[model samples]
Target: MRVPIYQVDAFTKRRFAGNPAAVVVLPSFPSDTVMRAVAAENNLAETAFLVQEEGQYHLRWFTPAVEVPLCGHATLATAAVVMERLSPNLGGVVFQTASGELPVARSADGYVLDFPSRPSEKVSSPPDVSKALGIMPTEVYRNQFNYLAVLDDARNVRDLQPDLVAIAGLDRSGIIVTAPGDDGYDFVSRYFAPAKGVPEDPVTGAAHCMLAPYWAERSGRSSFVAYQASRRGGEVVCRLCGDRVELEGSCVFYLEGQADISL
Candidate 1:
């Protein structure tokens, strides 16, 4: 079988700057083993698979190591592929995913994603957090999926060199380091999920689900321009609305091809 595949750089207008995710448009859902093997073979941070059902889509995301419940950048990448390449006239799409129903709408420039808000609760720092990140965070918070480490400044967040092994050993699947941003951005962050096969994510959209609510509470504002400070940095516009977070970003298509697989 020849499966259609596309690679897109999410959260960036230019190529190679954002997180690249491979999107496979499949006629039907494949086996878990097959999907996992495809993700491993692609070797990207995440691979998104989509199957049309009842005029909507069922989406699943996988890291090279494991399947994740939620992934923002890959979701955005899948939206791009569906709207731009597959159906140009389509204005929006809803994806039924492990996280829930995710809606993507087209904007003048790119797309806006309506994602579930993930509010983290403040907590005492874990013993290994400082050792893992090599710097003590001013505060720590925990949610169901990740640990949020608040730093004093963006420089510390940008310059951090963490012990990936220690990070992997943390209780949470991922750790997000964040601080106030300069250069007109509201906040800057970096994400590490070594246990999930992503040592450092370039531009994480899912991380901002926790970030938007936290920053809104801190600054008394509900909207923000966030930057993920990685080697290939990307920007995201976020807003908190009740129980949902609106994330906006653009995508750049990099590769389009077919994956030949034996059924």
Candidate 2:
């Protein structure tokens, strides 16, 4: 079987600057083992698979290590592929996913993604996590998928050098470390998911789902301009609306090819 595949750099206007996700558009859903193997071979932060069903699309995300319930960058990349490549006439696309229905639409600012807001609950700092991160955060919070670590300075978040092995031992899928931005950005963050085969993600849109609400409650504001402080940095525009969050960013197409897999 030959499947069309694309590589797009999400949350950045330029190639190789943001997180690169492989999008495989298939005629039908393949075996879970095949999807997992493809993701492992791609070896990016995430690989998104799409299958058009009825009138909408069904999407799933896989890391090299495991499948995740929600992934914002991959979803953004998938939307771009569907609207820009597969079907240019489409102005938007709705994806039925593990996290429920996710909608992405084209706008003047780029592709805007509507995602559920994940507000984290305060929790006592885990000593192991603090040790693994090598810097203690002022506060710690946890949602369903990840741990949110709040630091006092952006420099702390940027300069962090954590132990991946120790982080992989944690219970959650990943950890997000964030602080107030120094430049025009409203906030800066870095994500580590050694347990999920992503030691450090370049630009994580999903992390902002939690960060937006956390900062909103503290600053009494509802909108933000966030920058993911990874080696290949990227920008994310965020807004909190009731129970959902809006994340806006652009994508750069990198590679387009076919994956030949024999069954």
Candidate 3:
């Protein structure tokens, strides 16, 4: 079988700067095992697979090791592929996913992802959490998806070098370390999900689902511009609505190729 694949860098205008995701547009759904094998072979933070059904797309995301319910960067990259290649005249696309229906629209700035807001509740930091992170956060919060660690400074977020093994031991899907931005941006963050096979994500849109609400209450603002302080950094624009969050960012196309796999 021959599968068309595109590698796109999400949340950045330039290549090799943001989180790269592999997007495969399928004529029909493949078996879970084949999809998992393809994702493992891609070996990026996330690989997105989509199939059109009844005029809408059904999307799924996979890491090298596991399939996740939701993924922001990969979703953004998928939207780009749908808009640019699949349907150039399309102003927007609605995707049915494990997390639910996600919609992406083209905007003047870039692409806007309409995602559910994930507000976190205050919680005590787990002892191992600090040990894994190598530094204690000022406060801790938990949502359905990840643990949000509020640090004192953005520099701390940028400079962190966590023990991946220890992080893998923590009982959470992922960990998000964040702080107030120093520059024009509102906040900054870094994500670690060793358990899910992503040691660190360069630019995470899913983390912002929690961060948007967290910062909105703290900063008393509904809109924000955020920066992910990874080695290959990128930018995210966020806005918190009552029950949803709007994330905006651009994508850079890196490569397009065919993957040959035996059926």
lDDT, ranked from best to worst: 1, 2, 3
What do the candidate models score in CA lDDT, each in turn?
0.95, 0.93, 0.92
Q: Write the per-residue lDDT of candidate 3 for residues 87-202, one digit (tens) a residue.
A: 99999999999889999999986799999999899998888888889999999999877899999998898899999899888788889999999788899999999899999988
Best candidate according to TM-score: 1
Off by over 4 Å in 1: none
In model 2, residue pairs whose N, Cα or C atoms come closer than 3 Å (at least 3 residues apart or on different chains), thus clashing, are none
Clashing pairs in 1: none
Candidate 3, position 137, lDDT: 90
Q: Which regions in candidate 2 have their CA more than 4 angstroms from the true location? A: none
Give the range of the ten consecutive residues with the poorest summed lDDT in model 3. Answer: 254-263
Cα-lDDT of candidate 1: 0.95
- Residue range 1-263, candidate 1, lDDT tens digits: 79899999999999989999999999998888888889999999999999998788999999999999999999999999999998989999999998889999999889999999999999988879989999999999999999999999999999999999999999999999999997889999999999999999999999999999999999999999999999999999999999999999999999999997554
Q: Write the per-residue lDDT of candidate 2 for residues 180-211, one digit (tens) a residue.
A: 99788899999999989999999888899999
Best by lDDT: 1
Error of 1 at 21 (Å): 0.5
Cand. 1 TM to true fold: 0.98
Off by over 4 Å in 3: none
